[model samples]
Target chain A: MIGNAGDMNVVVCVKQIPDPANPGSLDANNNLDRSSKLIIDDSDMYGVEMALQLVHAAGSGEVSLVSMAPNGETAGLRTALAMGAEKAVLVSDDTLKGSDALGTAKVLAAAIKRIEGADLILAATESSDGYTGTTPVQVAEILGLPSVTFAKHIEVDGSTVKVQRQTEAGYDEVTCPLPALVTVTAGVVEPRYPSFKGIMAAKGKPLDQVTVADLGIDAAQVGGDGAGQKITNVTAAEARKAGEVVVDEGDAFQKIVAFLDQLKVI
Target chain B: MAKVWVLAESAGGKVSSLSLELLTKARELGDTVEAVAWGADTASIAGDLGAHGASTVHDLGDLGTSLPGVSVAAAIAAAIEAGTGPDILLVGQSYDGRDVAGRLSAKLDKPVLTNVVGLAAGEPPVASHAIFGGATIVEATFTGSAPFIYAVRPKSFAAEPSGGSATVAPLSVPETGATNAATVVDRHVEERSGPQLDEAAVVVSGGRGLGEAANYAMIEELAKLLKGAPGASRAIVDAGWVPYAYQVGQTGKTVKPTLYIAAGISGATQHMVGMKGSKNIIAINKDQEAPILQIADLGIVGDVHKVLPQLIEALKARS
Candidate 1:
């Protein structure tokens, strides 16, 4: 059933990240303030949009969302639902606070495993806030599935999924079988804004709420207590000191050249 | 004396610059530094790895034409299980490096420290991460066990040759399994007319201040005249003025060129993070208060339209 070409069930990992445009403060726990209004991360939108397109192309499929946010935040998940995700499974628990990348991957992997038959899992390469860029592949490892990262383009045919993985020099063409995981890069696809009708329709979509206990994740194995890596110190980066500023005299271009010449870069 | 492992990423028998950078840094943090490469014959690059301070090279022969994430991670995990792993494993922050690090983290049940820009030698070896659009630095250390994996960003450390030789050893390649199902069938290299953005010594970038898309041609012309690469800001890329590959910002490619010229770009924090590491910055913007001007070694408060053409003409006349 999972190998059926037309029946592609994709699970997209989304996050409710703090608005990056707004300066966010750290709470006493050293975590980003969750009380502030959160929105669906721009990076995650690429994955959501890619999943929607892939499922649409297959003609018969469903796109579900998996997210782990504190205080059972559905604000971000609702946005993805409005963008056309059929359903969502949000794992929210107070004890899950400060769960690092590995812990988050464990929870997401367990939730995905319980989703009956998921053919593909899609995620953003990294979150705008944390930017760890390792969670999706970690989830793939936990689930014992093949995974690809930095996918700029993806195509699913029969039991195989192919991708154009971005690289420093250019890109590499990669193909993986069904039940694989792929992390999409931002700008890979243009995400559509939620139309008024889609927004209204999203209100009725099923957003299943789960807890660590439901997923059988040991409470001690997650959160700050279980994190293998701990931040020992946080310091502001040395601010760049103001440099020489010159008003655009007619010779401003000449000054720039002299400076470049001084650096021997020309 | 700790043992350190650096994942040497090689393509077509050439060692990646990032791997060499990690090997150079690994030599300082451990008593012994070994590099692991995946290919049919890694002997050709063994000297290059040794020159970067690797005492030994483990070559995983012929892992097929796949992405190498699954097979490499599986082989490394098996080696660790057999007590042949190093105390710490450092991987580059490239696409394939991150894949291997993630899979290894889950397979070994150990968390990976990623986006690390600096490392301090200590009992557990603290890793420094640049966060909040490069505004803050956070120092973290592993608490649980050895063989802690870290994905270090490119250009974090300088690579230098030590004129040393290392012994090359063959590592048994593991059989491809279900997790190794991904394979590369085709590749399309973006036809680049100039030096690669990340490796270019000089980079000339434009932003929304260019007004119209056609104005970007002047930027390309100036970059070409300067023998540099052309780059774009997130604003221009988002405005559909350029492709995503040309973007230079926090969400885009990180560049540390020797000289970075920003034309008509009002430096936002997002854009600054990507090129702030550049050794010399020259910002040409009409707005004097652009955040980029603060970091520019030479800030020109002028319109790019006025400055770029004259500069191009001057360069052309000089040549």
Candidate 2:
């Protein structure tokens, strides 16, 4: 009872994050800084790409995006939109500043429900930043939909979604009904860069910005107040002291082998 | 006295070492330590769990091809609703563990603390997580509710057996209709040689410094010569030079081997956190200033292309 009628409506959960290379420090409240400009997470791009490809394979569907960013940030959504997504629902509220993983999932699931007729949902296994790695499955739980994580490959046959779910050992072929959610692994597909025409088209794409109140979520149930955990303190980890530094004088391998020998491991 | 429950996993009728590690940590944190497991072998592994300090084992029985995420989570939530749940639930940072934790969090409307590396006993129990690729350690504690869930990283604690026996308790999985629709149709375990990456005493990891994908063969050969395992940095794994399973870094496997040999790896903080715990580290790189060398017991400032072959030959000659 899950397959769609040929037109597969795919929803991708996209996250806009601070650049991992120049990651910002925690603010006074120990929350990650998001006041500055943000870009789409590199990890989420694979989900975006997978969503687009699935829609393409379905022949008559569209890819929609759901994101929660501060200040109604549309920059990250624009990138995904340029990649041929039809529209997006952005949840931006001042009260959602210090939202934890569960709070964020609540907001996302609320926003996703607004998109009608979505047959499948996709998200990255974990974000590049804030790798809580539970948002997609949490969203599925809230929506009462089946979920699969760590997908290296995905295909749609009729109403069933088949995923090659990645595991530490290898991978498992999992099949779920339509209207399910999947968290895609990174590098599953090659994401396309935005071209001039796509970028221009993205500007006109419908980016419906909403607030917590608009999504029928209480301000008290989000941000720091609703968070179930608090960061009591943060300190530098004990650094390992630097050890012997010897420039390889042709006997470097010998020294290494000797060290291994000393350890009785070789 | 706080009650702690660990989500245990088993394969080949043996409890996973990570689960035992969690059980060990749970014993240190709580007066009552219990375990929750699914699958047909749950009863078979109860004794092992008991030896690891679990006094009680909640068995969800066999799932019959259905993924454990939905049913296992529902069963735990049902227990909590019945006022028989633990004060804290510790789950390993694994695929099924994350799924169960996330679903249970949603079901109970409680937040979960993930990436935990340390824990200390307290009224509510505080957990420590490494942030920014383990550069800064953040100590956090639950604020809202009991049965606080923590997804702990593997190898964070040592698994020790304390002589005991656990009483198996049957827990029924609530009828989860649509959410339990996903089922495993097939499984494929890749052919692996040598010891497992995390369990291997000697681990030789390569990086982008290996120059090309073909050069990874040297890493495999050297690890084979040393009777060890092969690993890789995120750079080469992202480059598609190797599978993600070989990755050893912030987002990958956490290895604490006796001897770790990093070849051509620049030792990004992300990479360092994963292998820095090794008892002895040896870094071979052309760049004398590579960060990996700083923590290495033996720093060999040389090109891996030249140094690896020599090490391989030297190791081969000895054998």
lDDT of 2: 0.89
Best by the lDDT measure: 2
Error of 1 at B181 (Å): 0.3
Over A23-103, each residue of candidate 2 has an lDDT whose tens digit, in order, gives 458999999888778899988888898999998998988899999986788899999999899999999988998999999
Worst 10-residue lDDT window, candidate 2 chain B: B268-277
Which pairs clash in model 1? Answer: none
lDDT tens readout by residue for model 1, B1-319: 7899999999778999999999999988999999999887799899999999998999887777788788788888888988998889999987789889988898888989988899999878999987766778889999898888999988899999988898998877567577788888877677789898888999999999999999999999988988899999977776678877898976577899989999989877678778989888999999977778888889999988899999999889878
Q: Top DockQ: which candidate number?
A: 2
Model 1 regions more than 4 Å off: A1-5, A245-255, A261-266, B211-213, B234-245, B250-252, B264-270, B285-289, B300-306
Docking class of 1: medium
Tens-digit lDDT track for model 2 on B1-319? 8889999988778998999999999988899999999888788999999999999999999999888889989999999989898889999988899999999999999999998899998868899988766768999998876889999999999999999899999999888999999999998998887899999998999999999999999999989988899999978887788998999977789999989999989987668868878888889989987878878888888989989998889988988
